[model samples]
Target: MDLNPKLPTLPAFYQQRIEALLARGSRRLLGLVGAPGAGKSTLAQVLASQWPGQIQVVPMDGFHLANVELDRLGRRQRKGAPDTFDAFGFVALLKRLRTQAVDDVVYAPSYERSLEEGIAGAIAIEANTPLLVVEGNYLLLNDSPWNQVQALLDETWFVDVPQDLRVGRLTQRHQQFGRSAQDAADWVQHTDEPNARRIEAAKAKADVMFRWDS
Candidate 1:
C-alpha cells in the first residue's frame, strides 16, 4: 500500500538531501520532532516506506515509561510529558543504533497506544538499513539526556502545523483510543497543550523547519 498517495509527495529537494546522506554509505539517523499531533510519525513512515528496506523508523514513544511505573512515580496524569519517558534509556538506544557493528541487528521497543505500554524488541534495525528515521516530541529538547539525542542525529527536522489543527488531531486520537469526547477534549487542553508549548520552544534547534501543510 502507498503510505502517502493522497498526500503531497515530499519535495524533490528534501528527497535529494536525504539521498545524499544515504550515498555516504554510513548508517545515519534523521530525527523528526514536533508536538504530539504534528504529524511526525506519519511523515517518518511515509519517508521510510518510500525507501523500502533501506530505511526504517524508530520512534521515541517506545521509551515511554509504563503506566504502572508512571503511576508509581506520580506522573500518570502527565504521561506524554518529557519527564515521563526513560530519557536515559532512549539515549543509550540511540548510541547503540549509531555504533552497532555492520552485521549486528539491533532491536528497539515500540509503544502500543491501545495498551498504553511499551513493547520491547518490536522493531529491528538491520545491518543493511542505511537510514533510521526517529520521530518524537523531545528530540530537540534542551534537557540532559534529550539534549544528548541531538548530537547523535545527523539531521533533525521540526514538523510544524497550526495549533488549532494539532489540537483537533489530538482530540480525535484520544477519542479513537477509548476516551469520551469530553475527556478527550479535556486531555488535549490540560495535558497535550502544555506539552506542545514545551516542544515549540525547541523548534529553533532543528536543522530544518518543515511545515507539513505545504
Candidate 2:
C-alpha cells in the first residue's frame, strides 16, 4: 500500500482511474471500505465532486437498522456492527444497481448522523450513472451478505490511517454528536475499537489500498 497524502494530486490521480472504468460504458460500483473515522466518506465526496453527474455516492450507513429495532434486538450498543445493519437489504439494493438498466431513477436510503437513523429514499441515483461510489466499513468483510458486496463492486479500495489518528477523529466525532468526553472515550474503547479490528482484518481483500492523513 502507498501512503496517499491528502493532496490535490491524489484525487486527480483517482479521477483518471475512475474515468477509465467509466469508459467501458457499463454501470460500475466502486467501494471505499475502512474503519470508522478513516475518511472514506471524504474521499467518496471528492470523487463524486470531480465527476458531477457521472458519479453518485451510496453509503452503507444508509442501511443501519433503526434505533427502535436495535433496542428491540438488544444490539443498540453495538449499533455499527455487522449485525446491526440490514445486510440482506443492502445486498439487494446493490444487486439491483448492478443488474437493472439505468433507465429509471433508483432511490436509496441515507443515514442522518444527527438523528442516528436512516431516512428512506433519501438518495436518488439518476438514470445512466456510470459510477457508484459505495462507502462502508464492512464492504470487505468475508462474512455472509457482506461477502456478497465485494463481488458486486467493480473495484474496492481500503483506506488505511494510523490507529491513533483514527481514534482521535472518532473521539472528536462522538463529542460533536453529543457524547460527554468520558462517555465518548468509553464507547471508543468498548465499541468502535473492536469494530476497527474487524475492519482491519479485511484489508487483504481490497483490490487497492492507500493511506490518508488528515
Candidate 3:
C-alpha cells in the first residue's frame, strides 16, 4: 500500500478507542469501503500498521470472477462491476470468518493486481484475530449478498478524494500496471468513473465518510 494515507483519527470516526476495536473476548469486523482509487485499502493497512497483532486486512477484491469466467460472460471490460464478483461466495466466507471456531484458521482470497486476478487463500485469518479490517468497493451496496456485508461488520468507513486527484492516481496506477497512457485514461473515464459515482451514492450508508488525505 502507498505510505501517504493516514489513519482516521477523528473521535467520531470510532464508537470507542482504536484499542477497543480489538476486543479481548470477541471478534470484530470493520469495513473500509470506497471506489477503485479512493484509498480504502491504504487506510486499512495504515491502521493495521499502527496495531500489528490486533488487526488484519482482508480485501473483498479476492472475489473477482476469473478472466475465463469474465470472458465467458463478456464482462472482461467491466471487471470491477459488482456483478463481476462472486458476491455470494464472499458473503459466505465472511459468515464463516465471523463465527470462526476457537482453533480454526480461516483463509481468504486477495486480488493480485500484477496478474489481474483473485488468488485463493492468499490471506490467513487466525482464530485469535481480534479485529479484521475488510476493505472493498461494495460493502455498503444495498444489493442482496452485498447488503449482507454491512450486517456482518461492526463499523464501516467510506474514503474519498477529489475526482481530479482520484482520476490522476487511478490513471497512474493503470499505467504502472502496464496499461498505456491512453488506455489508462480511457479506462478511468469509462470504467472507474462510473463505478465511483455508484459508490459515492452509497456514502450515506457508511458509518463515516472522510476524504483520503491527498
Candidate 4:
C-alpha cells in the first residue's frame, strides 16, 4: 500500500499513469477526485495541455443544477451538496461517450464559476480522442448519483494536499469570486470542510493516490 515518497507532484505521476492506460488499447476514461481546492481541475488542465487536443477534459461542476433550478428545488443554499448536481444527466453523458466511435464528437457541459451556472456544450470530446479526463470533488462519493460515476471510469485517482493548504486555497478562491474574507473562511470551515471530510474517506476507491507536495 505504500507509494513513492519521492514523487514530486501529482502531475508527474499522472503522466506515467496516462501512458500506461493508453498502452492498453481501450478507450480511456480517467477520473480525478478530490476536495474543492485540492487541485483536481488544475491537474486535468495539465493533462489536457500536455496532450493538446488529443485529451478531452470534462469537469463535474458542469453538471451542477442551474441556479434557477436550485432555487426551484429549494437547494440553492447548499449549492455544492450531492443533491445539487444533475447526476442523471452526467451519467447519461458518460454512458454515451463510453461507446462512441472515433468519428463522433460529444459535447459536454462546463461550469463557469463567474457565471455561477453551467454552460452547455462548452467542451467537446471528439470521437478520435482516445482519452477522457474527468475531474471533480465528488466523483468518488458513495451517495446515490455519485456512486455510479466511478463505475464508468477506467481509473480513478484521488488527489491529496495538506488540509491547511486546501483550506487556504478554497478561501482565496471564494474571495476571488466575490465573497468577503470572513465569508470565505466561514464557508471553507463549515460547508467546504464538511464536504472535504466526506470525500477524504473515499480515497480508498482510487486506483492511485496523488499526494501533492506539502
The prediction achieving the highest lDDT against the true structure is: 1
Using TM-score as the measure, name the better of candidate 1 and candidate 2: 1
Q: Clashing pairs in model 4?
A: 102-127
lDDT of each: 0.89, 0.88, 0.85, 0.83
Please, what are the lDDT tens digits per residue for candidate 3 over residues 1-214? 3424555554444535456767556998988888888887877777787778888999999999999999999999988999999999999998998999999999899999999999998999998988899999999998887888999988888887877777787888998899999999999889888988888889899886767557
Clashes of each: 0, 0, 0, 1
lDDT of 1: 0.89
Which of the predicted structures, 2 or 3, would earn the higher TM-score when compared with the native? 2
Candidate 1 structure quality by residue, lDDT tens digits, 1-214:
2212223688887898789889999899999999988888888888877888888999999999999999899999999999999999999999999998988999999999889999999998897789999999999888887889999999999999877777778788898899999999999999999999999998999999878652
2 versus 4: better lDDT goes to: 2
Residues 27-120, candidate 2, lDDT per residue (tens digit)? Answer: 8999999999888987888788778888999999999999999999999999899999999999999999987664778899999989999999
TM per prediction: 0.95, 0.94, 0.92, 0.91
Scanning candidate 2 in windows of ten residues, the lowest lDDT window is: 1-10
lDDT of 4: 0.83
lDDT of 3 at 184: 92
